[model samples]
Target: MQQLLVVGDIHGFPETFVELLDVGSFEQRVLQLADLSGRPGLRGDNLHDHLVKKDGLQHAVRALRETNGPPCFGIGFSSGGTALWSAVKEGLEIQALICVSSTRLRFETSPLNIPTIVFWGDLDPHRPTEIWNDAVPECCKTYAGKHHDFYRVDALAPNSPLRTDIGAFIESVSGLHSGGPAPAR
Candidate 1:
């Protein structure tokens, strides 16, 4: 059985992601990255560049249960997706990464140990596909609409087409166990 650990944006959207996971039948074995926010959505005085480098994730690395075994896959949605990429880059033992409507951080330059799948919305202000392409080796899944179209938070809006290919993408990327590190000069 493949265990998918779905991570949502650190800013806001943990509940939305959790609801989606439940609807997707992913109730067990999913991990949500917590926010260190003293007040919800309040980022405080931290520098913008270091925003995603959360102490919560760092602690997760230390407190993770080695007994449950490695997750078969990791799904990073929005900002959490990038965090997952960073965690993998920092040597976390994950099999693969699936990033949706997200960008790659500057530190994510080298080719990763596992394959990755990136989902991008054409109008997703974030311009996910463009960022991921420049930094990571991922199969890009582009939607004809915006970022929120891919998300099923409250409900799938009429304009948002059903994503029939995500499961397939996950299957494909998961099968690719090894890939070369990003090219070095």
Candidate 2:
């Protein structure tokens, strides 16, 4: 598999995000890029232009396009998640996408066919389960926590279902050899 780019949140500290990569066993396969602006974690407006500027996605595509490795699989949370989507919308072409708590995606229908997974909390105040259900249907994974609970903290649990599922998804996507567009999940 190629490098795993952990796009830190605009509000997230670079140090904390690096720690998260270490805990997730992804530190070894990282794509070190320019310093990310803003804080880490989700807070709506606080993250957006500061975290992923309008051309950030395009920049990542150009930067990684010449890399000597297989396609990348991105894991984003909250605002980071939506930014990844925007990147895909801008034709970033990641191998796979796993997003959690990217609220307000119920209105986005830009024809994403990648091997995508969208996690929905049972008690999310932002987007309801039905919304995610209607959006990805077969690709959505439902968790037993609130919106905030879907953060990397929940993923840190050794026996967490979210962690296991993410591992499996990454493995599966990494093995893909066809350069064709990802099929619907």
Best by lDDT: 2
Task: Estimate the TM-score for candidate 1.
Answer: 0.63
Across 34-137, the per-residue lDDT of candidate 2 in tens digits comes to 33321323333444553345554345445444435456677666655666666666666677787767664565764476877777676887764564465662
- Compared with the true structure, what per-residue lDDT tens digits does model 1 show for residues 10-103? 4444454332321233333444444422223333234122344545444443333331564666766665666677767766677777777655
In model 1, the Cα lDDT at residue 29 comes to 48
Per-candidate TM-scores read: 0.63, 0.65
Runs with alpha carbons beyond 4 Å of true place in candidate 2: 13-45, 48-70, 128-132, 176-185
Whole-model Cα lDDT of every candidate shown, in order:
0.51, 0.55
Error of 1 at 36 (Å): 7.6
Clashing pairs in 2: 10-38, 10-39, 11-39, 11-40, 12-39, 12-40
Q: Largest TM-score belongs to which candidate?
A: 2
For all the candidates, what are their Cα RMSDs to the real structure? 7.1, 6.4
